[model samples]
Target: MNDHDLLETYEPVLRFAKSERFFPMAVEHYLERCSILPSGPLGAAGLLFHLNEPLATFIGKLEGGQYFLRFINEPLYDADA
Candidate 1:
């Protein structure tokens, strides 16, 4: 089979609970709402890239450092309540 068919055959299905409100979003949309932060010791230094910044700018900031995307900056409703 071709690469596309192989990938499709192995793709796993995602099952979400009825109460689950969050869902996957497009990378571009997610990037627009998220900021880049250093994942390790550098995290204390604060944010590396602000929300809505260009992808190139985000990539430019990643050099010899560990980073992660912070999608939600605020706390959500209490789930246990």
Candidate 2:
């Protein structure tokens, strides 16, 4: 799945106190990193930092990293799931 698709995948669950737009920003960061290191493995922490303060707290920095790690590495990953 491409980085843009992450928006659609998380749109329903994505939450933000400041602005919903921050979510897309985070997704863009993730996508950018992926493009730079397509073959290299990724962690959510890399993308999570792009999020604003409230959004970062909502997801929990380290926890967010774990989530991305699992989703990216899992055989059958589903953002909605």
Candidate 3:
């Protein structure tokens, strides 16, 4: 999936989070961090790798709490990093 597709897929969830007045903050925070990285332009795969952990953490926090967010999930795919 390309960046556009990735965003499209997550846009609804993001919108939902915004509707609930959450997640958007976390998403913005993650974007801030990602922007600093010199990863150049990346698409869906790039985002999945770079953000899987952070996004999962954010989601977990929203769902249950920091404690509930598992850091032991399968590794994400990072392209030629």
lDDT of each: 0.67, 0.42, 0.41
Displacement of residue 14 (Cα, Å) in model 1 is 1.0
For candidate 2, list the clashing residue pairs, or say none.
none
Q: TM-score rank, highest first? A: 1, 3, 2
Best by lDDT: 1
Measured on C-alpha atoms, candidate 3 has an lDDT of: 0.41
Lowest summed lDDT window (length 10), candidate 2: 32-41
| Candidate 3 C-alpha lDDT tens digits along 32-78 | 34422222343322444445465534333332121212122343446
Query: Candidate 2 lDDT, tens digit per residue, 1-81?
Result: 888898778766646787453345465345433322122235444544545443323433333233432123334436657
> For all candidates, what are the clash counts?
0, 0, 0
Winning model by TM-score: 1
Decide which is better by lDDT, 2 or 3: 2
**Which parts of model 1 have CA positions greater than 4 angstroms off?**
38-68, 73-81
lDDT of 1 at 36: 69
Question: Model 1 residue 40 lDDT?
Answer: 78
Give residue 28's lDDT in candidate 3 (0 to 100). 53
